[model samples]
Target: MNRENVLVIGGAAGIGKQIVLDFAGRGKKVAVADINKKALDQLINESGRPNDIFSFEVDVSNWESVQNMMTKVKETLNSIDIFVYSAGITKQVSFLNIDWASWKKTIAVNLHGLFFSTKAVLPLMKNKNGGSIIIIGSGSAITGSGGGIHYAASKGGAFGFMRSLVGELGKEGININVIAPRVIESDMLDRLYPSEGSKNTLKKEIPIGRLGKPSDISNLTNFLSNEESAYIHGQIIIADGGRTFRPKSG
Candidate 1:
């Protein structure tokens, strides 16, 4: 099999970091892009595959930054086989307390970033004649959350964007999909539920008896990037450990 050139945005921490590692473990050449240079350095150092893994400091919300990073990836890797958009931001703010600055920032990082990243890679992927684009979304888009209206709106837009792009991209042999994970054990989750007891209480409500792990989502991402998932497109695979289906009172 030809070694794939994978680009993971927001891949310096949490689920994005795990996805980078997963791709590298599978012998794929991985390029991780993030705004956090320290975290990117830590990820590259920890991987121990200096040649196979590279990092770029990129602000996904900025079009120029994303374009520059994409150009560098093309120059470095020759071609991009998989592109993952995992750059996002969210906060717990009541609807009444929401401000324009905060809302704009949330949408800029979450929705606008995805758009910029995807737009930057489309021409490259199209030139290659095949590629996969994966967007990391949230279940909050499905069942509205009180404290994260901007986050929910941004994620919901992601779903719509993927669905809209599949048809156009598919014609060019490119696949796009969204993976929505709920209550995942990630830095974002830590910020949302700081206490271990609080996490455990939420975990008990899941049918799987535990919170979703970064690996869980990365595993599916790996599959979706491979030929096995060629038939799947524009689909939103919810990785919530069955939390969405459980009764409200349960």
Candidate 2:
């Protein structure tokens, strides 16, 4: 099989890092973009085929930085066949208690970063005729999760972004999709459910009786970024192990 050149933003830790390694292992040349230089270097060093993985330090929240990084990645890899937006942040605070500064910072990283990164790479993917773009979203987008209202709002905005992009770019032959997952055992989960009680309550709510794993998301993302998912576009596919199917208790 011919290998594709894939670009993953935030491909340094957690779910993003898993996706980067998965693609690289499959023989794809991966361009990893992240703000953490140390993590990026760690990923490169850990990848047995160092030549298959290129690292770029970038702040996806900044349009200029994203633009420049995309340019550099394109130059290094020649063309990008798959682009994944996995860079995001969250502030677990009561909706009313969140200050303006914290709210802005959350929005900047979660929503604005997705916008900037997607826009930066659209042209490059379009130039290659057609390519896949998968965005990592959260189940908060559809649920009333406490202490992460801003995060939910940002994820909801991403849904709107993906739906609109489908109409605008699907005809252009670009495959766009969003992968939303429930509480995964990542750094984000550690911050959101700090206490054992909080995590226990969440586990009880999920029908599957377990938290999500990075591979749960990476596997689906891998499929969505392939030609097999060509007919699957403009959809928000949830990979929460049937957690969101539970009914609310009175």
Q: How many clashes in candidate 2?
A: 0
lDDT of 2 at 10: 87
Alpha carbon lDDT of each predicted model = 0.90, 0.87
Pull out the clashing pairs in model 1: none
Candidate 2 residue 88 Cα shift, in angstroms, is 0.9
lDDT of 2 by residue, 192-244 (tens): 78999989988887888988899889899989988878899999998887888
Cα RMSD for candidates in order: 1.4, 1.8
Q: How far in Å is the alpha carbon of 99 misplaced in model 1?
A: 1.1
Clashes of each: 0, 0
Candidate 1 per-residue lDDT over residues 150-221, each given as its tens digit: 999999999999999988999988889999999988899998888999899998889989999999999999
Please list all clashing residue pairs in model 2, or write none if there are none. none
